[model samples]
Target: MAKEKSVYVCSNCGQESPKWIGKCPGCGEWNTYVEEIIRKESGPKKVSTGMESVKTRPITLNEIEAADEPRIDMYDEELNRVLGGGLVQGSLVLIGGEPGIGKSTLVLQTVLRIPEKRILYVSGEESARQLKLRADRLGSASGECLIVCETSLEQIYVHIKNTRPDLVIIDSIQTISTEILESSPGSVAQVRECSASILRFAKESHTPVILIGHINKEGSIAGPKVLEHIVDAVLQFEGDQHYMYRILRSIKNRFGSTAELGIYEMRQDGLRQVNNPSELLLSQDHEGMSGVAIASAIEALGLF
Candidate 1:
């Protein structure tokens, strides 16, 4: 049997050290070191026999075929416009917002609107009954949507493999933990590992994933910097809790433009998409109002 190896790793920069240090030399962060156990293996792990592996062939640039892939159509036109048309397969999206900013409500509404696709919504914070109550209140009773209340990444993967859903939504990434790491949930290590695993699954299965993440007191995603880099897109839901209007902004997009924005209005039923945004911004009630001017803004994809 091989002895287990242990090392202290900096939580900020992932630098390994023989012993705990008060300050991380790599990132210059103080008191960010944490000890982790490293298991020793005798040989390389065996590959699974379920899937057959194929070799790749190198081809010339001219021989490669290029075509514009169509995006998935959604019932919400405003959301489709903001996503640069619609959602793309095998894309990983990260959505973050403040508490009670209507992040969950926005995603739940989207899921309800898309009835053609099979969606798997995994909640780590809420129970199935709680989600059903919210869905009922929002009038979102869909037969195609599956709800699973789980916090373990391993169990989540198992459900994904069995269900084979077209879309997957993680309510909040901070609450999910992985078995590979010994740290608790919401830790830097656990967050990175869990997100990477989900990203891999989405890519390999050619399924789109929407990950809802919690922001820290600093209003940033509560994870390492690499978590943002691993995903294909990052969206932020911003608005005051007291305000009736909410904004969904794309910060990073690999398949589309990031300048697009989606606006929604909070109501007793649910989030209502603002189709004619200009009308809402400039109304007849605001006529003759000083210092207010109406300007025409053109969108790239002819949405406006």
Candidate 2:
């Protein structure tokens, strides 16, 4: 038997309350508290009699072996730099952007170009044919990449276990729903639970998971605040949809530098990596422009 449990949680700040309130006391947000269902302990409790097992081990830090592990170099230098020289193993990255901002295109291009690893791209928003058409236009579909059109998390997990891909990309996390949550898909509760399950799977399997998420009208991730904290990195893709330029900015990174940014130019064929970003940034023939000076920063990779 399970006991009935009820609580109120703020949608904006993720604050919890024992009783319903019109305004959140912690964040001072109005009309953000929503009643949530939580399972309470109902079974009989048993007290531990004594310690059944004990083990003591001491190890010195100097005795541990250390080695410099190499990272997989990607075709795009800017992305590689933003990911701290490369994508680390067992990392979970969240990419959020507005609709039609080329988030899907960027991941698809990466999967096609990464020849060394086997990638599994699971699409919940788009069908296989639709992805194929886009892949054809971008010239990104390769033999190493596998595409699956599924929305259920259970089916996705099954495919992941059988294929054992080197990398996994989930197109838009809002569409994914778990069975444990009674709320509908895309709800605050559903999104949080689904993301947690994915995070656990990624860490336990030592596989990198790339999650695509949609942003609200306020330019933030659509789900609750906990979604951002569960992942290892949060990358915000920002740029005008009409413009050819796209910027991949890192908001949070556990294995890499957060200050790094990647810039790319969208094209009909595919995304072109911009080597010298300043060239595109500055207007042509601005040699004698007023209040403008050409500043140079010497990058360690090379002079830019």
Candidate 3:
């Protein structure tokens, strides 16, 4: 067994320090350092995953196949448009937003509409009963959606292997932890390690994983900067809690354009996709009003 020692690590950049400091030298953020336990082993320890062993080898550019990657339709036109038509296979997508901003509702409602695919919805923040209640309110529940309230990373992989789902969803990355690391869940080290492991699993098994993450005080994803770099795409769910309209903006997308956006309206029955903004943005009362001029402009893969 290896000996353990505690070290201060910055939550913003994953920088290590011998002791606590007021500001993070790596990211220049204040009060972002947290102590984490490290094992003094001879070399790095490998994370055990349920994915099949498929060794990768480098190949010449000419030998590689140049075919269009397959995509999974989310069934929501707004989400599909923002994801550059549809979600790509083997892609790891990270969705971040403020709490109570309808992140879970949007994902649950969308997945429920896809009855053909088998989806594994794992939640660490909410219980299975809570998710079921939300699903009941959302109304469709047509797909073969399995819900599990778990936080252990190893257990999650076990569930993945047993279920072999077509799509996997992690409610929030902050709450999931792995036994490989002694750091608590939501720590910088845990978030980085878990996300990297999930990304590897997604690629190796050719299964898409959607990770919902929390935002920090600065409004960025509550994890190290490398977390964003590990995923294939980063999407931001933005809107005020008091408002009915919400926006989904693509911050980074390796397979498609990042300028696209998705809009949804929050209602009592669930989230309703807004296919056309003209109907909501422009009202009959606004017609023939002074200082009102309608013009055509392209934004978020649509004409407005």
lDDT agreement with native, every candidate: 0.84, 0.84, 0.90
How do the residues 214-256 of candidate 3 rate in per-residue lDDT, one tens digit apiece?
8977899998988998899999999989789999999999888
Per-residue lDDT over 1-304 for candidate 1, one digit per residue giving the tens place of the 0 to 100 score:
5457778877666778989999999989898788877656667779788567656667999999997755777678776766778888888899999988988888898898787789999999899998988898899778899999999999998998899898999989999998767678887778778888889888888899999987777777767767788999898888778778888888898888888988889999889988778767676776567997677673455556
- List model 2 lDDT by residue over 23-132, tens digit each: 87777879877777776567788978766664555689998788543456667798888888887788889999999998999889887889868889999899999999
Residue range with the least summed lDDT across 10 consecutive positions in model 2: 294-303
- What's every prediction's RMSD, in angstroms? 6.7, 6.5, 6.0
Alpha carbon deviation, residue 108, candidate 2 (Å): 0.8
TM-score of each: 0.83, 0.83, 0.88
Q: Which regions of candidate 1 deviate over 4 angstroms?
A: 1-37, 41-54, 283-304
Best by lDDT: 3
Give the poorly placed runs of model 3, Cα more than 4 Å off: 41-54, 285-291, 294-304
lDDT of 3: 0.90
lDDT, candidate 3, at 15: 86
Which candidate gets the maximum TM-score versus the true structure? 3
Distance (Å) between predicted and true CA of 231, model 2? 1.1
Ten contiguous residues minimizing lDDT sum, candidate 3: 294-303
Ranking by lDDT: 3, 2, 1
